[model samples]
Target: MPTEPATYPGYRFPAAVIHHAIWLYHLFSLSLRDIELILAERGVVVSHESIRRWCLRFGTEFAAKLRKRRPRPGDTWHMDEVYLKINGELFYLWRAVDQHGVVLYILVQERRNATAAKRFFKRLLVGLKYKPRKIITDGLRSYGVAQREVLPGVRPRTSRYLNNRAENSHKPTRRRERQMQRFKSPEHAQWFLSAHAMIYGHFRPRRHLMTAGQYRRSRDQALRIWRQETCARVVE
Candidate 1:
């Protein structure tokens, strides 16, 4: 079993219950209500709203911890934008994931224009502090401009097949969106996704490509990261 971080100062629920709810929410695509009911069967009688709060507060933190402890991303990046409908209007989610399929950055915008592209590029580069050797994107002019300004000298490749990795990455988000009906507001969408991306980044293994031993090691590493991030404590 995994241990909770000392920095948590102890939560309302046991670490096991908190961890179980989070894992179910992320791993099985279960909503807060669904997770609550699932736990109820196991003799934990937490409310759906409580589960929701747990996910909102601790999910991203756990994922951030996992990311900090994981291996660095590959030097190649894949960028793409997917349309999200909110209140019958269209919005865009610009995401950048590295060669190893680790999500490096994500931004929710009302448009997919040059300004939006520039903003996304800037956000993506802010924490990286290093340039990628190659960037893959579809034939979007905004991407071209942003790449020129933000990541100049790096090869920006646009082609049908090359950008498939980025396009495929949107599937999980799409599934979750469909399950939830639709995002109520941009803020809600951003908040949920920002947390969701980090959680998704943590437990997802390279199952199709890696061997059993490699996958097991990856899983263990992810768990270790979660423990360290959530358990960090400073002595008084």
Candidate 2:
């Protein structure tokens, strides 16, 4: 079998290297400068700004491919909204994860009212193209209102404890927030987290349910698909 070479036009670095840098940024709470230093130890001399540019260029493209390749998510979705402070302004980060803890989607909005909730619901329905069987959320009145208007048929369960999965999923975002000293803007936060959530979830399977060998194999398969999506020959 012949493996076609990846042509990352107008870039001198190989596609694998670029994708690896992007992977390092998302898979952990590493900053651009941190990624630069890590790659420096590997004999690849590149500036942090260059890595940031690479992330901006390819992160969304790679994440979209990964999202499309993912299996159908669980029917029971857990949704949550948390406040984010970007530039000292309040922004609401709306997130949804399935019962299996796979991130379904994320949105950054300026409000957390019924209108905002409906918007998130609509966006979710567009991506899923179907209604989830049930949704669990915190005791937010907006969720109840949104469910009635947007998803009239789906049952909604209000529980702060049962929605812990969605809350726990925000931990990674928190870590990244601290690592980056907070996002510069709402757009930047959404753009970065959009890719980060999908890619991060892809590599982090439920290791507790898997044997050591199964965990390793799962991670390896994730890497393989990540490479293909980035049009790279291998994971560097």
Best by TM-score: 2
Q: Ten consecutive residues with minimal summed lDDT in candidate 1?
A: 3-12
The lDDT, on a scale of 0 to 1, for candidate 1 is 0.81
Q: Write the per-residue lDDT of candidate 2 for residues 1-236, one digit (tens) a residue.
A: 66544548788787767889999999987878999999999998999999999999999998999999999988899999999999899999999999989998899999999999999998888866677899999989999999999999999999989999999999999999988889999999999999999999999999999999999999999999987788844322
Local distance difference test values of all predictions, in order: 0.81, 0.91
How well is each residue in 26-106 modelled by candidate 1, as lDDT tens digits? 766777888888899999899998888888888777776665666778888999999999999999999998887888878
Number of the top-ranking candidate, with lDDT as the measure: 2
Q: What is the TM-score of candidate 2?
A: 0.94
Which clashing pairs does model 1 show? 5-230, 5-231, 6-231
TM of each candidate vs. truth? 0.90, 0.94
User: TM-score of the candidate numbered 1?
Assistant: 0.90
Candidate 1 residue-wise lDDT at 128: 60
